[model samples]
Target: MGKNDFLTPKAIANRIKAKGLQKLRWYCQMCQKQCRDENGFKCHCMSESHQRQMEVFGQNPNRIIDGYSEEFEQNFLELMKRSHRFSRVAATVVYNEFINDRHHVHMNSTQWATLTEFVKYLGRTGKCKVEETPKGWFITYIDRDSETLFKERQKNKRIKADLAEEEKQEREIRKQIERAEQLLPPEQNRESEVEDSAARELKLESGVKVGFALGNSAKLASKEKTEAAKLVFEEPESDRGMKRKADGGGSKSALEELMREEEKKKEKINRKDYWLCEGIVVKVMSKALAEKGYYKQKGVVRKVIEKYVGEIEMLDSKHVLRIDQQELETVIPQIGSLVRIVNGAYRGSNARLLAVDTDKFCAKVQIEKGVYDGRVLKAVEYEDICKIVQ
Candidate 1:
């Protein structure tokens, strides 16, 4: 037939049959050629180029098969690693994805006779986690990359470290519980008597007791005054609204006299005998006047009133709160010292120290900026204080 005639229907049918993988078994591995049929394959074997290729392959047939097997395995594993690195996939499912690449090495040319055999080989070599399910064989890529191994090792190490830290904390807690139990025996009687105000009392890590007798006495005195119908003075205003200015003055004097008498009674208690220092923190007890919002406020002791009562500067520094010693808790940080907060929402925040209860290790801090900036003070722990260099 003429070259133009080869494009006819009969000739086209012949050409179509010669292409594609219809006769996979008859394909040449060394020459990388396929034939149309048995006759065509016989003719291809007789060709000069085919003879030269076959002659070279014949020198070491096993070498050629080994090369093909290696190529096939490498390409298959690369596909599995890239496409299904994190999934457990069926063998057939992976095979389907692998064949999508037209240039992929065919299994027939390799040593593995079937996909099952290749999967078994992969499992045996520990390249993949393999399992036989009811449906079929499933495979998951075994991540053996150096980076992946390192990350896994790091994760395990962190988990182990966390477990160890937790165990240490538990051990510390057990020790604390034992110590508390031992101390409880000696203080049980005193603790029962003090139980009523225990909730109001702040305990410091350091064992220093703020005097309570003065606070209780002040409470009793205040209670007696309330029962006696003592006239409470109103805020000083213009005489225009006063029924009698003289009456107001007389009432004020009476109030002063009553206070002086109370002071005299407290003086017998000897205030200076308990503490040797000033600027210690104390809680303003319940008996303190609530109108100034100092009933439960924190203040630095400017002076001790009658051994138990304290004349203190409130957190604002603008007001003073005078209360019995029981209301005050000694805070952690010392006054006029610089300290950094270590716990709570303001952790890592730096502030100037205003007052401290050395017994309790609790401090009142004055923060000028940030979330803690306000007229009111923040109470924090001595442990939370980060020491400043200068």
Candidate 2:
């Protein structure tokens, strides 16, 4: 009907020409035009519309280029997130898929000279995990979405609960210790110390091995006779009640046994049967998998199936495996990470890691939850704690 109508040959041809990707060098970023050939691009540069755009770009070349660069980066990453999320993909592969849009901001207009440089930039800024292999560069997206943040906050909430619990335990322990101290008063302690010093304390120099001689029977009998002459069953200057109080049925020692019994009771009650939580790193301990060579390998807990089962995604191989929690041991992260005490007097308690002793294969941690918060365990072995995957 009309010369430039949608049905017209000219209009159809224009659509066909713009259907797929063209040479990037022939595209003008400022004019937002794609020329089919060098001759067409050269001619378009001489046109009035092109001349106007060039003049505008000339006014602030750096600002215009920067704007294009930012847009390009944003669009590229958006495509990456939408398409290759949770997968390791080659830089060129993603770039190839990106160019199929026909209207993507060309790399020529961006600050980066090549795709490799752009991939390296992503790695440096920690936006993506980048690696260069013999095959070329590959990237995996790092998720820092609100969902992840929500999980971390939930984890922090759990830690706070742990801190409160630990604090209570500490208070109880302190109270018991105080009660024991009260039972053993200063005066009784001094008397016990004096008696102990007389019996056991020796003012011997270091490395001096003193020996005693065995005299004849006659001298031993004479010494025994003198000791028997001084033997008396009479009470001391103190009253009989005080004497009875001095040896009062292992008073301090009995209190210590009471404390130990209380701790054992706590250990039985607080130690949970379920320690499997979502989003934690754990090791495969099932001997059944040893045949498949997965034993002792680490994985991330994607989901907790039941209280005792987890859907784990292996770290090295990226394979998802359904494993029982009993067959999985939790992993320990770096210092300052929240860890659960798997076994110990503090079993099933959550704690914050304080320091590591690599040579001893042990870690120092402070209990962070229920009754033990602020209590520091200085030499917990590596096997006794596993990191919380927040």
RMSD of each: 29.2, 17.8
| Residue-level lDDT for 236 in candidate 1 | 28
Q: What 10-residue stretch in candidate 1 is worst by lDDT?
A: 226-235
- Runs in model 2 deviating more than 4 A are 1-19, 184-192, 195-390
The whole-model C-alpha lDDT of candidate 1 against the native structure comes to 0.58
lDDT of every model, 2 decimals: 0.58, 0.70
lDDT string, candidate 1, 237-332, tens digits: 443235245455333333335434543443332222233125455555453256757666666667654344456777655486544443444444
Provide the global lDDT of candidate 2 against the true structure.
0.70
Q: In model 1, how large is the Cα lDDT of residue 311?
A: 65
